[model samples]
Target: MNLLSDSRCGSEEEVRCLLVLPDINILSHSGVSHTVFWLLGIPGLEDQHMWISIPFFISYVIALLGNSLIIFVILTKQSLHGPMYLFLCMLAGADIVLSTSTVPQMLAVFWVHVAEISLDRCITQLFFNYSTFISESGILLVMAFDRYIAICYPLRYSSILTNSLIGKIGVAIFLRSYGTIIPIILLLKRLTFCKSNILTNATCKYIVLAPVSCDDIRINIWYGFFVLMSTVVLDIVLILHAVFRIPSQDVRHKALNTCGSHVYVIILFYGPGIFTTHTQRFEHHIAPHIHILLSNVCVPIPISEAIKTQALLS
Candidate 1:
């Protein structure tokens, strides 16, 4: 039974075939089976897809334009060449990558009824989606530290956070982001996804795809959880701790003022993220479409907020 021999298996009926294939050996025997996964875009809402796609289209456009402008302004303007603006540029770049990673595929699933994704493309998307997210979290933490030094120790700000230091921090952020994610991809590639390849969302996510495999996914789940806690949660804790260390009210206010945009960006990025993670774990009764909607909504908020924040700062 060569799964790849049939055209229907590569198209609309892929999920049905995947669900019906009972034997793992049958899938693995040919060495070419199960190369594609079917993405279910907002399951149970096939009729309302046009309406649902409107918001996604608008959000993607706004995010792309807004983040691009931020990057452009930061790069072209000589006056904006500082540690703070450099971090914002990195954030904007991450937002662009993150948004681009998911939105186009989502649009294809929504508008063209194209839901089948090859494993390689799916894994590539998954890698960029997560690596950019981890990078964004790291950049936010660096921005917080930048604010801390600027306000808490204004005299030593330039001496401590020099361009060389900022460059080193940027490299560290890239290493930290990509280093943690490479193992997840390796783990994913090792799994044999002989079970149903129907993903509940329009885009590929680690949590969504990990369960479709017949092999054990406990390590993937645990490591993903660890990365979330160590990066974003720890960053939030350290940022708050630093904010409280300023003894004087005026200094505290100033520090917080500088961090206000970043704080809002953090809230916008992580608030829905935490909610979605909890819902996925504890609220299994929730409709799959709701998960898709929440995931889509969460990606664009940071770019929108970044644009607003940069406007105010300028």
Candidate 2:
């Protein structure tokens, strides 16, 4: 714990505070400080600008354009109107929201000399990000179920997954995503942040953010793990089931082709999440940047392209 005081107040007794930098010894289950910031020294990270800024900028632009085009095409073209396309539209909308919430702020963090964010804005970012992420996951799950119905019970697929039913699922996804995160945010709201406020990553990530406040992050961690496992992991299982249950060989092959890209997207979407799971216990400067970049920008373009190609072929 490093202690520093305000000396410019022109007082004999200065107001003192403790500054604890994040620990570098990233053991499998090491505990972090109540308020930790960087694994490496901040000054050390500040010097490595190119690794932080350039790739992130390029990736962000790519994601924005790809998602935007998908949304536009889905809206304008009547020929693409179907359950699958509806889900794709929802997916594109979620991707756009997800990218917009984090990318610009991240770019500022890496490129700008005087990048600063208020506490409120950071929380807002986290809220939007988590909401979008959850929604995307839910949409993917619904899509898997859609494919299952379409292949397994082709005669009843239309009746089973009607427009009203799909709309309900969409609402359910939004509710589930946003609702689960409310409790975590409420828990964090009780904690107090009295130390360093510089966010190393471009986005407001809850895993890394929770450690900054002076409170026990056990609840936040447990809740996050539960939600992620249930939503993401379980959804993947459902997707796998859908993939394997196709009756016809041709349908099976086509199903694989259709879902393969989404599976890749799902992996890319959740890859950074592994790092986030450890964020409460360890604070690596490069870790957050890498995770944020991957989650926010790197994965969206390829996924969008896959969606477009599949839509055209179908």
Steric collisions counted per model: 0, 0
lDDT score of model 2?
A: 0.64
- Pairs with steric clashes in candidate 1: none
| Candidate 2 per-residue C-alpha lDDT over 143-261 given as tens digits, one digit per residue, 9 for 90 to 100 | 76776677677899889988899899988999998888788778777767543454445466686577665667778878888888877777777787778777788888877766666
Residues 1-314, model 1: lDDT tens digits: 33333334434464566555442122533334377787767756765777888887888888898889988998999988988889888988888899899889988887886777888999999999889988988898898798788778879988998999999999999999999999999999998877655677788988788877888788887888888888878877878788878899998888777666676777678777667766786556776667767767777555436634853365
| Best-fitting candidate, scored by lDDT | 1
Tell me model 1's lDDT, rounded to 2 decimals: 0.78
Superposition error at 217 for model 2 (Å): 1.1
Off by over 4 Å in 2: 1-45, 48-51, 245-257, 279-304
Off by over 4 Å in 1: 1-33, 303-314
Worst 10 residues of 1 by lDDT: 22-31
